[model samples]
Target: MEEETRLSRLKILKDIAELLNKGTDTRAVLSEVLKNLLNVTGLQTGWIFLVDQTGGYQLAAHENLPPALTLNQCAPMCSGECWCLDRYLDGRLDKATNIIECKRLEDAVDFHWGETYGLTHHATVPLKAAEENFGLLNIGSPNKTHFNKEELALLESVALQIGTAIKRINLTQREQDLALTAERNRLARDLHDSVNQLLFSLSLTARGGKERSEDPEVKETFSYIQDMAQEALNEMRALIWQLRPRGLENGLVSALKSYGEMLGLKMDIKVKGVINLPGSVEEAIWRIGQEALGNCKKHSSQEAVTMYFTAKEQEVIMDINDEGCGFFYDEEKELPSLGLRSMKDRTEALKGHFSLKSEPGKGTKIRISIPV
Candidate 1:
């Protein structure tokens, strides 16, 4: 009988390993694993939290949660602090172990939030790969309060698999991002060396022809061509800058100020914290800033803009403001016309916040907040 139990556990581990290795989408992988884990192990309930460096967490996956815990569409699971998260933030939860009765479940029981279904306690484990700690895995059963050595071992092993899978996914994503960046650099160089140069030459040639022409109509035509070519050249340059940001290494604020000036705007820049940021954060900021300033130049009709930058341990914020001819639109309407959608997409890619407030004659302000 003992030999049969060991073989079954081994099979479960093998099956889980296969599941973890099968997918690129983090949430999808975790959801499937959590469901199967509970079914095979006889545990009735489980969940996983994917936490960021800022100590913010997302409930990545859950299984067989009782109605009380699942009340209001899992609002109980989504909000507020609990013992596991507190220990995780404080660095005390280092391994698989039984924790005190779950505070969340306790609250639900005391407040009559829902049926507890006999659940009172849970086992918690830190999900980590080497020195990089990701988050926590929690599992429990009806009327189960204490976890035995065998239970702890299973939790530990499963947590190890989950953490390693997360690390591998992150590395794979990094490699793909690096490859995409390299390709962008090559494309930017090619455009700058060929089409960009041609546009510059065309603009200059038109200007020269305008000067040398005797006919007013011919000069006017030359002037129109010159203007079109110069506008196209400026647009191309902006695209190149997006493809390969040149000045972000100095710092985000400095690069932004330089970019704003390049757009022919007087830059009033104010920064509140020591400027330090990762490359990914900086890239997202630069791209979003570029779009905001471009919108100002094209629609705001204002020559001066203000940029406010603030950095903190958990979050960084940027505000772009222009006291120009702002316009109003229906909030429900799609806003792709002014590059707002593109900017929003870039900010959200970093799990950031994007908000815009504008009214006719009231100016425009775009605020972006991103976690570090």
Candidate 2:
């Protein structure tokens, strides 16, 4: 039986490595790792907590968790001083440690919180490579009284593999971020040097022609051309600013307010709760805001727009409303407008929700809610 168990562990480890090798996204990789760990090890529940650069623990992935340990209940333990985290931080939890008792679980059991399936103990393995500590991998089973040395060893091996894969994914993401920033800078420079200069020159030439012409109609035409060129120049600058927004370094709200001012739109902004979010989440919100504002400028005649941004414990909400001319369409029969479709796709890609409302005379409102 021992030999069979050892062979089975080896096969499970091989399968896990294969799955991890094919994963590209960190979240997806961690989720698959948890799933595989539960399936192969016969554990009832599994979870991974990742330590961010700020020394905060974030729940990266989880599977088969009992109701008593729902995400909301587990959230406080993630950031608070927990046994596993304290040990990991102090470099004591370097190997798989079988925790015979967990305070959180014990409290839940004592309080008669939702079902825990008699899970009283769990094993935690630090996910580390070299000197870098990534996080902790935790697995628990109701039937198992204690994990053996061999099982602990298998857990350690799996944790090492997960740590390596996470490191690789982080490096790849950094490379991609650098590449994206470089491209944005290049595009910003090109637009300023070429199109911006051309528009400025056109405005100057149109003004000069208006001043030189004696005919009233000719002067009026030249004046209109100059105004159009100037407006185009302003729009171009706004676009360039968006391509390489310096204010985004400060925060999303500041960047968006600046953009709205540049577009000559009066913005009524309301914010609630703290706005700390992941980089990708912020980018998605910015892009969606940009698209919604663009549609407003093109379709709506209203000069003022209102936006409400709210950040809750687990999600962020953004609502943009403009009192402009709206159009009617059958939701079931026809597809959404191009801009709306793009917004929907972006929201859904992040596992969020997007909704739009409009009428013939009434204005348009777009609401997006995304989990952080």
Candidate 3:
């Protein structure tokens, strides 16, 4: 009987761990915990309390408890208010071999949670892990001898397992945040190097050409110089368009059409999946299209190209196929163009994968898949 009880508790703990791994929302996890706790203890009314960073407890979950008892969003009682609360605060709950309870309100707190619900007995266990405190798991009943020693012990073990799961979630969130920050920083640097430098050069040329136009002999030369500078300025604008964040107003399809017009090439764009996306995703996809089309124009012997952009529930996919003669991926190994490298980098920077498929006789195809 003892071992069976232990195994049952272990099964509950395992479910909590599985919930943590599924990436469910915190509130959902709390709700699951509350439901499971009620099932395990056969309690009609209870509340799961948590200690905030300020050492005040808040209701995290409740089962059939009055809205007033569970919905009181204020900080919980201080550690000095109850022995159970004090034990949790002192980190003794995790180290304990048995469940502990504060049978008297004066021992846990001089509060009226039980009186309001006509309940007198309850159990409290610490919810904690190595790095931080999660809060407390407390279950209550109106019956005088409702909680047994074995039950308390089971609850305590469950609390430790909950703490570990919570800790894992917190760690995962921190890592994701760090990765996002690093990606933003990398994009900032790339924008500075690629687009900003071209604009600066265009600015200097425009100013110098305007000054030279003031002299008659230099006027003719300035016109020629001005024309060349204007061309550079136009190319710079195109580069900026490629690098800047895109929107649904100019999504993959529209952007491709615009690029076709700019290049004076007859092309068609087909779009599938969700057309609207965040700017970072749009920017990365646009850069990939730019590089692929640019390569088609520079290398392909064919005149027309077709671009397809597809979005699935979890990924964004792109296919750029040109009719021009294609070069082998292995042949390009020794000499990689800057444009292709830039496209690959942009896709990868978004946690996406990029690949190119081509043969000597077949047209080149660029493929990209980014997570949604």
Candidate 4:
């Protein structure tokens, strides 16, 4: 029991720390806390009540509360309401712990709120950091007298950790967004002013030189330069497209098609797909494909590769199969090269599924799927 309790605290602290590092918004932070709370307590129902702008707590995560409480149909806490919070706010209940007895609960606050709502026994703990009361954490049970003093004390500790962690997550999310935005802008401008302009000029030069060059060698040289310039421009444009914080609104089809066409010269690649996923999802897959194809050209001894993209209502899938000599998948036999790691990171960063299948003498196949 002691070990379980300690691990729970550590896990909550670690997750909250991660959340703070991620820089998610307030609601998202709270949702994560609620999820952890559910895991720690193993309660049948629960809810998080956050202090709204109205100076009273509003229901944020009411797992099994009635539609009224769960959806927050009722606004700020009111005096004499039967809700458990009424007792807490009235100072008739203990603030040091969160668990409350169902039978002992008293308030004109609408006892029916619990009786009809299917919550018999539950605990209401104040989510406080230092001395400031930020919110209420409610854990419910269908059976009477389910929560005890000891459980409430543990919950109090959990609440303290949650409050601080949520604040950190919000701060981190803001900082991360600001940093990403700044980096994206810097990269976008660099490509536009330098690489983009050069490619445009070269394309025009190659076309213009065609009429002026009477020498066959000179014409071929200009043609090759033009081709190289066009390819470079396409890639630069793709990078620019990715640099857009808004992401690829054109969806996976457009992203893959553009990427494949841009890469056709260096590698024999075929891409086919039709999708309209969120910009983030599309960008993730596009980047993964880019990294995978780059690997094919750099390391894979294959003549050609084909990428099949498909999306249904719930999932978006991609298959990159190459006829090149494949490597061993076992860690003991082979370590993940930098290129493979990059591919995995791209998928994981988007919270998607990434898998690789390969063996000596056989070809390699990369399969990835993300929720749409």
Best by TM-score: 1
Q: Best-fitting candidate, measured by lDDT?
A: 1
Question: What's the TM-score of each model vs. the native?
Answer: 0.92, 0.67, 0.48, 0.48
Q: Worst ten-residue run, lDDT, model 4?
A: 70-79
RMSD, each candidate, Å?
Answer: 2.2, 7.3, 18.7, 14.4
lDDT for model 1: 0.90
User: For model 4, what is the alpha-carbon lDDT of residue 131?
Assistant: 55
For candidate 3, write residues 1-372 as lDDT tens digits: 978877877887787666656754555676687687778667766556667554566566667754334324423332236666667777665643323344434322355443334554567677777667888777776554355677777777777777777777777777886687567656756766776676567667756876857777676666666676666656655554554423326556777777755665678778786645665787677667777776776688776888887888767898888867787678447326788888888887776887887888888878888876
Q: What tens-digit string does per-residue lDDT give for candidate 4 at 1-372?
A: 989777876776677656545545666666766676667667666767776322455556555554433223443222224445665566564554434444323321254333334444567777766655667777776554555666767677777776776666645766886788679989898988998998999999997897699999999999898999988887787677567533345555455555555555233344445556765676677778777776666566764777777767667888888777887797454338876777777787665788888887788899988876
lDDT of each: 0.90, 0.85, 0.67, 0.66
lDDT of 2: 0.85
TM-score of 4: 0.48
| Comparison by lDDT, 3 against 4, better one | 3
lDDT of candidate model 4 versus the reference: 0.66
What's the residue-level lDDT of 261 in candidate 4?
54
Clash list (residue pairs), candidate 3: 51-135, 57-76, 82-108, 99-152, 99-153, 302-324
How would you encode candidate 1's per-residue C-alpha lDDT over 4-92 as one tens digit per residue?
98898899999999999987988899999999999999899999998888788889999989899899899999989999999999998
In candidate 2, position 10 carries an lDDT of 88
Error of 1 at 219 (Å): 3.0
